[model samples]
Target chain A: MDTKIKTNNTTSEKIHSSENIDEQMLERLFRQFSQEIPDDGFTDRVMKSIAAVSQEESVSQKTAFSLKAQIPLLKSLNWFTAILSVAIFLFAGGPQLVWNSVFAPIFSNVTSILPVSVFRWTFDDWLVAFFRQAHQLYSIDVLTTPLPTIYILLAVLTALAARRLALLTV
Target chain B: MPSVTDIALVLQVVTIGSQRAFATLVERHQEPVRRFLRSLTNGDEALADDLAQETFIRAWQGLRSFRGSASFRTWVMRIAYHTFLDEVRKSKPTETLDSNQRIEPNATQTDNFMLRHDVQQALDSLSEIERTCITLQLIEGQSIADIATISGLPQNTVKSHLMRGKQHLTTYLRNHGYKD
Candidate 1:
């Protein structure tokens, strides 16, 4: 290998002189430097450390997940939400069954007492009114018609309660 | 086909508590980080190994803070660079001097090994920042931006260090009649 000292008088001169050096020479030097990477169980040591740390983190995560899974309030609240949702569906459809089984004859009899304008109403008007009243039965109307409204409110409260319980546990 | 993003996803999973993912990270990055630290510390294999371990530990500790703004490799390398610096700070001051004191590999060694050792000693003579720049740029083959991120130096500063390091190495090789 050749050994000869190159000199420079100024800072920029030194920088510029490096540019003049052959590209192949620089590439060779870089290749030589690259070859110096260590190979003696280095990765094993790093992997071992990483394994230790990751094991600790995994343990902590499992503990947190299990702790969240154990909260009684959250468990009860989830059940409450499911049951209340079913109750809401039954309440909304239950009135239709009542109308068909018991109230239809009574509704026909009450036509005489209803206003004469209602009696003169067209088929479309009667159909629209029936739908409108059914909507009223299904609607949550706490300030207006309290029964269905209370059911709706109960379902919403149950959902909110479950969510809050879950949050607390997590 | 695992792209860089796939590797990054593995790292992210590792950060969130996956041992297998962490192992993958170690396997992928160990060589480059070892090479970079070895070059920076002037081929102290034992120290390089220790620093490499410390780097992974530090990376694991700081994994949650990684924001994915940079490539996973760059981020891990930055952690390794900082860990090496922290180790330098904590160790006895004499270690730095010892590293700078050059030694021939072996008298009976082959010519290639001696030449490699000579180049390494010439590298050792560089200032710490210059050594870091040269190691990252030449040995690690990091881009300028990545070197700046790893070294925590400004881009211009990194460039200056690379230029100065090359000039110093060139002068050293010439003095030893190793210049082509």
Candidate 2:
């Protein structure tokens, strides 16, 4: 192993010494005859290209920044719409109005079309019974109902937060 | 005006996007960069200048990535080398004979031009990697490590190329009337 190491060292030294000789010869050749390229207008051309590149970069950056800047305004608009919808819904008696005008009528109509002879009640009477039951099921107190105002508002807020998070991830 | 260092110029260009500072850097290094390209292109002055211009432009665009490990000159030479390789890859195979035939010597230096012509001919005797290693080491005065970095070759490979390139160059120049 020692002998192999010594052999490698000697070989490397030989290569290095010969490499030095070649370097000297090359130096002589270049020192005597190497040309210096004159800069007639190269710098001007490069600077012009650089200016164009810089202009392109800045323009793109500005466009990206403007797009980013509009996000807050969009977010504010979304919040305003959400809040206004909730406010209009609550001011119109919330769940009670939804039950009376929307869900209760649908339930009453569905029952009115079904057979009502099983209980000796007329179709209209059955519909009236279903209407009262649905109204009670949905409840009259907006804040205390099954689908409470607070629960709906919380759901809306959670949805908005989730949407914002999705957009950010994108 | 006091001459600033390349590092200072580089700092100004990076921090402030100073075109004037970058222009100064281009002017300072253009000679060596152009000469290196001219050698690699085998004396095609027009192509050499075009490649050199591209090298500086790329350097400017990527100035922020310069880590100050190598001198600005070595870094730019690396860029010039890669730009030359990219051009070569994009084009047909190199016609050194045609390129040599295209060389128009400067009128003022007939004897030196003749010597340079002979040198270019001798350089033609080497393969591409050998010639690049030789040019980077001898003409551009880069170290073996620097050549490795510039060529993206290992140090041992660069050393081998240098050894072989030196032997070929010496034999060619010697046969062509360059006495020891």
Which candidate wins on lDDT? 2
- For model 1, the superposed segments whose C-alpha errors exceed 4 Å read A1-23, A36-41, A54-170, B1-8, B11-16, B100-103
Q: Give the per-residue Cα lDDT of candidate 1 at B71.
A: 74
TM-score of chain B of each: 0.89, 0.91
lDDT of each: 0.71, 0.78
Evaluate residue A20 in candidate 2 and report its C-alpha lDDT on the 0 to 100 scale: 41
Q: Give the true-structure RMSD of model 2.
A: 10.3
lDDT agreement of model 2 with the native: 0.78
For residues A1-170, could you state the per-residue lDDT of candidate 1 as single tens digits? 12223333455576667685444565586786567444466666777777777689889999988876676545665656665764666466654565556765565567768745664544335545655676689863344554555456545656676577576765
- Highest DockQ against the true fold, candidate: 2
User: What clash count goes with each model?
Assistant: 11, 0
Candidate 1 lDDT (Cα, 0 to 1): 0.71
